[model samples]
Every structure is written in C-alpha cells, then in structure tokens.
Target chain A: MTIPLRTPDGRWRLWPGLALIAALAAGAAAASGALGRYELNVLTTMLCYLVLAQAWNILAGYGGLISLGVSAFAGGGAYCVALLASHTGAGLPLTLGAAPLLGALAALALSVPLLRLRGDYFTIGTLAAALALQAWVYNWDFAGGSVGLSVPIARSPDLAQTYLLACGAATLAVGAAYWTAYSTFGMRLRAVRDNEEAAAGLGVPTVRYRLAAFVLCGALSGLAGGLIAYQQIAFEPGGMLGPGWSINALLMCVVGGVGTVAGPVVGTLVVYYLLTTLLAGYDAVSLVVEGLLLVLIVRFAPQGIWPLATRYAGTLLVRMRRTA
Target chain B: MSAAVVLNGILLGGLYGMSAMGLSLVFGVLRLVNMAHGAMLVLGAYLAVLITAGTPLPLPVAGACAVLLAGGLGYVLQRHLLTAMLVRGANGPLVATFGLSLIASGLVALRFGSDPVSIPTALGTAGWSLWGLDVRAAYAVSFALAGVVAVALHLTLSRTRLGAAVRAAAADPRTADLIGIDVRTLYALVFAVASALAALAGLLVGVAFSVSPQSGTSYLLIAMAVVVLGGIGNVLGTFAGAILLGVVQTLAAAQFGGGYRDLVVYILFFVVLAVLPRGLFGRRLT
Candidate 1:
C-alpha cells in the first residue's frame, strides 16, 4: 500500500517524471521517421545501450550487487532467440517472447551460486562466470561455435519496425526504472543496499529482494541482447558476450548517475553521441581514452559524470538568471 | 591421463600456486581483490620481453629487475592513488582498481599492437626426459621458482617479526596501530609484495606460454578461481587449490580437448562455489 519515495527529502514527483519520460520517448519515436537508415540504426543501438545500462543500474546501484556478468545474461538471451528462430522455425514473436525468460532462468541458476558471495568476491565470481560463458558459447556446436548464428525470421523486420521495437523497449525499461526508483519495493531494496543486516532486522526478505532484482536486471539485459541480434540479423556470440559489452554498459551507468531513473537514458545519449559523432573515426584510440575516462571518473566524480555536469549546468543557470 | 600429462599438470600447478600467492596475500592482508593483478602480471611479462629485446642482460637478471620494477610501481600506486580511494569505502577501491586494470590493458594494447608475444629465452626451446615422461625446461624452471618463492614466503610469514606485524595488522589494523605498528606502510608493503609476485608469475608465463595485451581478463579469472578454491585468504590453501586446479585443467584438456578446458574449469568453479561456498580449504567466511 506504500507509494514510492521519489526524493531523499521525501517529495512525490514520480508521476510527473514518468510523464516527462513518456513525452520524450514519443518525441524521439516521431523524430525517428525523418532519420536515414544509417542514423536510424545508430539511434536504435543507442536505445539498446540505454536499456542495458538501466538494467545494470538496477542491480549495482540499487541492489548492491556489483555483478560483472551482464554479458552472460545478454548472451544467454541472444542465444535463446537465435537458436529458437533457426532450429525450430520459430517466428520472431515467439523467439523474442521466450528470450528474456530463458535469460531469467539462466540468471536464476547462476544467482544460486553467485548470490552466496558478497562484495569483491561476488564481483570476481561474476567475472569468472562471464568469461566461462563466453568460452562455452565459443565451443558449443549448436550455438554455431565461433562462427555464431544468424537470426532468420520467416519475414525480415524492416528498419521502421526494428526502430519502433527498440524505442518501445527503451521506454519500458525507463518506466521500469522509474517504478523501481520510486516504488516501495525499490525503497526496500535501497534499505537492503544501505544496511542489509538492519533491513533483515526490520523483517525485510533481503535475499528474495536481491534475487528479484538480479533476475529482473538479467531479463532486461537479455532482452537488449535479443534486440541486438534481431536488429543486426547476424551476430557472433563473442560480440554479445565480450567484456566490451559489460564495460560499455558499466561506463554508461557510472557516467549517467547510477540508481537514477533517467541516468541510463541520459548517459547513453551523451556517451554514444560522443562516440559516434566526435570520435567516430578514432575507434582504437577512443577505446583507450574510454578506459582512462573510467578511471578518472571513478577517482574524481564517484557520484557520476552526469552529476558533475549537472553541477556546472546549475551554476551556469544561476549566473544567467542573475545577469538577466 | 598419461604420466606426461600428470607431470605437466603438476608443473602447471606450481606456476598457479606461485601467482595465486600474491593475489591470496593481498586478500589476506588488505581485503582487496586487486583487480589490476592480471594487468600487473601481463605488464611484468611485457616488461621482461621488452627489456630482454633491447638489452644484452641475462633473462634471470632482467626478470629480477622486472619483479622489482613491478613492486615499486605497486608501492607507488597504493600510496598515491589507492589510499584516497580507500577512505571513500570498499566500492571506491574496487572501482578505482578496476579503472587501473582498464588503463593498464589499454596501454598494453597501444604499445603491443594487440599481438601475442613470448619470451625468447633458451629454456622455452629446451626440455628433459625424466624416467618415461617428457619435462619441458621452462615448466621445470617455473616449478622450481614457485617452490623457492612459496617456501621463502611461508618461512617469512611464520618465522619473521615483520611477518608477525603484517599478520597483526591484517587481523586488526586499528589495534595494530594502537600497539604502534605502522599500518599504512604495511599495506604498501603487502601491495608491493603481491604485485611483485604477480610479476614473477608473468615472467614464468612469458617463458612457458604466450601473452597478449588482451590476456588480462583470463589471468585475473584464473587468479580469482585459484584464490577462491584455495580458501579466500589462506596462502597454503591457495597452493593446494592451485595444484588441484592445475591437475584438473590438464585432465579436462586431455579429456575434452583444448578449446573446452576453460569451460570445464569455469563450470567446475561454479559448482564448487554452489556446493562449498567457503571453498575447499577456505579460512575466511567470504
């Protein structure tokens, strides 16, 4: 019966925030029609990144699980859809529908072993699992081994349909984030994050809450993977399950203000825009710079890259107002 | 498996034990996983490779210098960078170390051109036949090196006053400080020791196997699995775990082929984590 607590200072602005997000998504969807195929594909990938980042934020920022295995879940989901589509002659609808659940199941099984660990142990364990999964996929015969599988739909999805799908998923992901950020469930999760022993003392089922967050986040990551496979139409398991995917998603989350509802969406836009626009031709060096940026950001602005940006923006706004 | 496989596995185990010691030591003393450990190991190998390529110095001397260089770098990193991060809390250190790993890997890639490089030491091309089993000279040398390092570290921890101070600081830093121990210096020393050990392993790996800039993740993963299997912070247990893992790895590779070896090890690790969360010989609850 408890409504979400949106602000630490106890304000109720969840609905308005969600409405703003909905409006932004609608505007973006409308804008997509005017974009060329190349630009549309770029936006679609960015949307996928936003969803993935949101999923990561939910687990690490809110649930206190610093998991390094996002790629595993995403790969699991991608493989499920790809396999179903290729082998059983399943349509895109059925394969995509089952994708997230399959990912959820894999994550649930993984969590049994993983959730038993905490702190750095958990991080290490997850990292091990991730690398192992990648290796497994590389060796698995049915998953196409190193060559990977191409998703063959009975009817190929057009660019517009794919764009819409990504937009819808991103919107849903952001909405889910907003709900979690303000919902009583999110509050309980935060309580567990801040002080698990105290939360347990107050009768919170910390384990269950954590498991729920893990599975939910896994499902989100998995769906993003599925969407990537679907959009690209052909993908290697390495691309989906590589350390790069996890690192990119992690960068986005940290850059955007982890645990904030709009952080992932905003962060995704800023990072991808810079990567695609400013550093488009400098891929190799940009990667090195991104890695360094991660270190500098963690050291200098542990709160996030966006939070620092917001501070400067606020100062500028104050100065402009004063001048006016 | 054949006797050759068993011998090679045992030899491999020695290397694992040697590397895992540094990782295990840091966990025992500082309670940080040292994510940059793998990068440090690769950097050590790269340093050895680069120095030997440019200089006429013997492999042994260059290796020693590499280890010392790694130790000094570790000391500086801990004192200068990680100290401030530690004050923010555990996550700060974790993220910061991860960042260091990222930077190390990127720098390695930029320098090494993403290509695999091996040490050109003569041992890599030499071997001996013991009874009916073939023994690679590099593996045998690495085994001997691991034995020497492990015994030295073990004796130091058990018999030395400095070791006593480290154990005391590890057990209770605040109390150790109350009792007049220099806790900060101890942390720096432990970090340096851990990094140096990683460098030693890196040198061994460079001689025996090939390494690339991208090898950091795999090395880190192996180090983690060893530490966990051996028991979180127990050095002796880490040795046992490394031996067990080395044997299992050889057996798995023999049974399932080469490509499947990592898969087998990882799945086994997950199974172990599930069934025995504390690890086989773990001293710490984590």
Candidate 2:
C-alpha cells in the first residue's frame, strides 16, 4: 500500500482562489463609484481591518505567536506615510510604498529582542513595545508630539482611491493567507508552533521561520495602516497607535476563526457590522458586548464561529445523506 | 536628583512592588497571566472610593473590604470561568483574561464616567520628615504596608503546610493531583490571594496618585516591568526590582522631563529583558 505524504486538504488551490479574489476586487472597484460616501468609508475601514485580521491570524493562529502589538506596525506605517507626505512631499504611491518597508525594518529591529522571548513572555513583550512606541510618539516633537500630525490633504488619496488601495491590500493579505494555508512554508511553521523541539530535531530553522512570519505580518499591517492614514487625513497618535487597533484585530480573528483563510474576512464583516456599525456612538456598550462575545467564544466556541459553522454544516450533510 | 526624590522613589517602588506581587504569585502558581490584573487594581481603587464616599467607614476598613471583595470575585471567576479554559491551551486563558479586562474597563468607564478620581484622605497633603529625608505620609504608610504584606507572603509560602501543598501543585499539577491535592480549589484560592494583593496595591495606588478608568494598562505595564526585573514569581525580588525601577524612573524624570519618564522606564524594561531574560534576581518563590 502506498502512503500519502500529505493530507488531501493540503493540495494548493492558489490559482482558482486568486482568480476568485481578483474577480471580487474588480467588482468592488467597479461598485465603489456607486457607493455613498458613508458606505464607501465603512467598506474601506472593513477592508483595512481585513488586512490586519489576516496578518494577526497568520502570526497567532499558525505561528503560535500571540502578539498584542499590531498597532506598532500599523501606526508606524501610518506615521511613515504622514511624515513623507508632510515633509518630503512624497506622493501617495511613494508614501504607500515606503510604509511597508519601514514596517519590515521596524519588525526586523524588534525581532532581535522580542523574538528571544517565548510564549506569553513574547506577547507581553509585544504589548510593551506597542505602548512604548505610543509613549515615544507622544514625546516626539518630530511626530507632532501627542497632538499628532495631519497628512497633507493635497497629497493624500481621495475616498475612492483610498478604498481601492484598501481593496488591493486586503486582496494581498488574503492571498498571502491562502498561500500560508497550503504552502510547505506554512506546514513547517505550524510544525514549529506545535512542537519547537520536535521541529528543530527535524532540522527546521525555527527562529528564521518565526522572523519571516513576524516581518510579513508587520509589512501587511503597515500596508493596512497606510490605507487608514489615507482614509483619515487628520490622524492622531492616540487614534493611530491605540490599543483599539490591537483589540479589533484580535476580536476579528478570534470571532471569525483563527488559522483559517476565510476567518478574517468573515470576522471583519461580522464584527464591523454587528458591534461597530450597529452600536455606533455607544462606545461603552460596544466594548462590553465585544468583551462578552470574546469571553463566551473562547469559553464555549473556542474554534470560533467560522469553524464551528463549517463543522455543523459538515455533520448536517452527513446526517442528511444517512437519512436519505 | 535630590535625596528627597530618591526617597520618594523608594516609597513609590514599594507601591509598585505591591501592585506586581499578585501578578507574580498568580503567574507562579497558575502559570496563567491575568491580563485583567490592571483592571482588577483599578476596580479595587474604585471600590475604595465608593466605600468612602457612600459610607462613614474609615479608609483602612474600607480598603480591607475592597480587598476581600476583589478576592471573592477572583475566586469565583477562576473557579467557574477560567478553570475549564486552562486545559484548552495557553492562548485560551490569556485571551479570556484579556476579554475580562475589556469588560472590567468598560464597566468602570460606564460607572465612573472615565474621569480621574482619587481617594480622599487627610494624608493626601501630609508629609513626614524622617532621618533628614522628606516623605509623604501616604507613601510612608503604603511602603510600610507593602513591606508587611511581602514579609507575611514570604513567610506563608515557605513556612506553612498549605504553602508546601501550593508549591507542590505549582511545580507539577498532575503529580500534586495524583497525591490527592485538589488542584482546582488550590488554583482558585491562589488566584483569590493574588486578587486580594492586587486590591491592596490598588488602594495604595489610589491614596498615592490619581486613578481613572483607563489607568489599568499603564499600571499593568509597570507591574510587568517589576515582575520581569525582579524575576517572575519571586516575591522579594519583585519588591527589590520595583525599588530599582522606581529609582531609575525618578532619576530619568529629573533629567529629562516628567512626560518622558514612562518612555525612559519602558526602554529600561526592554534593556533589562534583553540583557537578563530570567530577570535580575532570577525566578524563585520567595
């Protein structure tokens, strides 16, 4: 008997997935002109959140690195765009292009000290880094101190352009996630996550894989932040580098389903519509609801809504066939 | 910096040590980082504030009540909500505690209006001069209280049979359970004790400084710094580390500006982590 080296689900579906994604992106772009300003803004925000959620999913779900510092990269990217636009007279495309590079560099610098810690220590380290970055920004006169700086509106992208940028970033994020879902790189990353000692015994370079994932996550988050900056012309450090960004990304991933390609997309849509849009202006109420949802989900539905729903549907299908 | 500033820093360090003690204890025993720790601290402060404002009880009595209440809440939470999640995985409890923190912060904000508030005390403006050094009366009392608590905790963990059981359970829960230790109940008790310690620290923090709904994360960061510097789970080490951090922060504040003190401390924390991941004192129970 021949033994299969990989699971049936491990087959790469990248080409078809890319085609579907491209079609969706094209459709969204076409519909953007018809969308009202409010709807366009909301959709743009959702897309940016989608990018962040996907990045966080890859790191925490697949890499087993639960980071609470998404804001560091996101805010760093936003600041990069803001600084370039305001001081260097960089146009939108250049600023956006430079944002991810800055984010990748920052991640590289941080991974030296941060990646040394393991598990919860790493999580706490990331939180510290995020908070430290926020504090530093508050004191940095070059970054406009606590008051924060505004990107020059003339050089910034309009709402439709921002939406298109967000869409492109979201598509890239999803594609990356899909690749990670099926690629050999992701399989090795998961092996390292599941058992570092075992993976190392198999000759996997654990640190290198983790560093790559971290930098990729940072780069994607930075791209999302650039889109956010374009969306909000007058951005402050508090709004940009806030814990809210981390919380939102975490909530989306946990609520949708971590470690799955479709999880972030579903999560972003559900969270944005259910908590953010429905409970707008009631910050305290929304926070309470979000917290409650997170607690209940982890306690009862730890696999998250997407995975749970899929499993339920699978069982239902089997039950129907058996009955028939 | 002046000698007075150093003295104040030492006093501040005492409070910092107290704030971190519960977190260290819980982490040491349960191996679960209570992300809601800062919120619990703020909750204690708010409880004390409410007790003083609504009732004629003395501040000391009110503070004790707040501590007990917080302990009870912690026990219930760990027993009912956190116990099952513990087996799920490392990320499970961490995420759950984070959710709890959000809930706590949101509730506090809803009730307290997000405005800064402080515990009203005669000691707020009172000062004491001892051995040619000036100290605030509140700081002096808080520092003494922290010392007493630390010594008591150290003695309890090392000298008592219950302490022995707790230590065994912490070292190996499966083995301890096989030996007839009710690890679940012990976990809850340890969590309760940690929460009480956090509440005590919170009360002290309220007396020494202003607190708002949003103060939890900042205090949590300070406690994390202390925990890391003192060596995670080391009670006395945490106390000493807090003092060191306090001194350095005060000196930095004096050199740069008050606004950059947090930045300086955070950088120091990162440096310490990079240099000594095991912490300055290394991890030990006492």
Best by TM-score: 2
In model 2, chain B matches the true chain B with a TM-score of: 0.97
> What lDDT would each prediction earn against the true structure?
0.82, 0.89
Clashing pairs in 2: none
| lDDT (Cα, tens digit) per residue for candidate 2, span A9-75 | 7664557777788889889989988999998999999999999999999899889998899999999
Q: What are the RMSDs of all candidates, in order?
A: 2.9, 2.4
- For residue A13, model 2's alpha carbon misses the true position, in angstroms, by 3.8
What share of the reference contacts is kept in model 2? Answer: 0.66
Clashing pairs in 1: A4-A182, B231-B282
Q: Classify candidate 1 by CAPRI docking class.
A: medium
Q: Per-residue lDDT for B102-197 in model 1, tens only?
A: 777777777777889998878888988878689888888888888888778877877899988988988898899999998888889989999999
| Span of 10 residues, lowest total lDDT, candidate 2 chain B | B260-269
Worst 10 residues of 1 chain B by lDDT: B277-286
Off by over 4 Å in 2: A1-10
Q: Residue B112 in model 1: shift from native, Å? A: 1.7
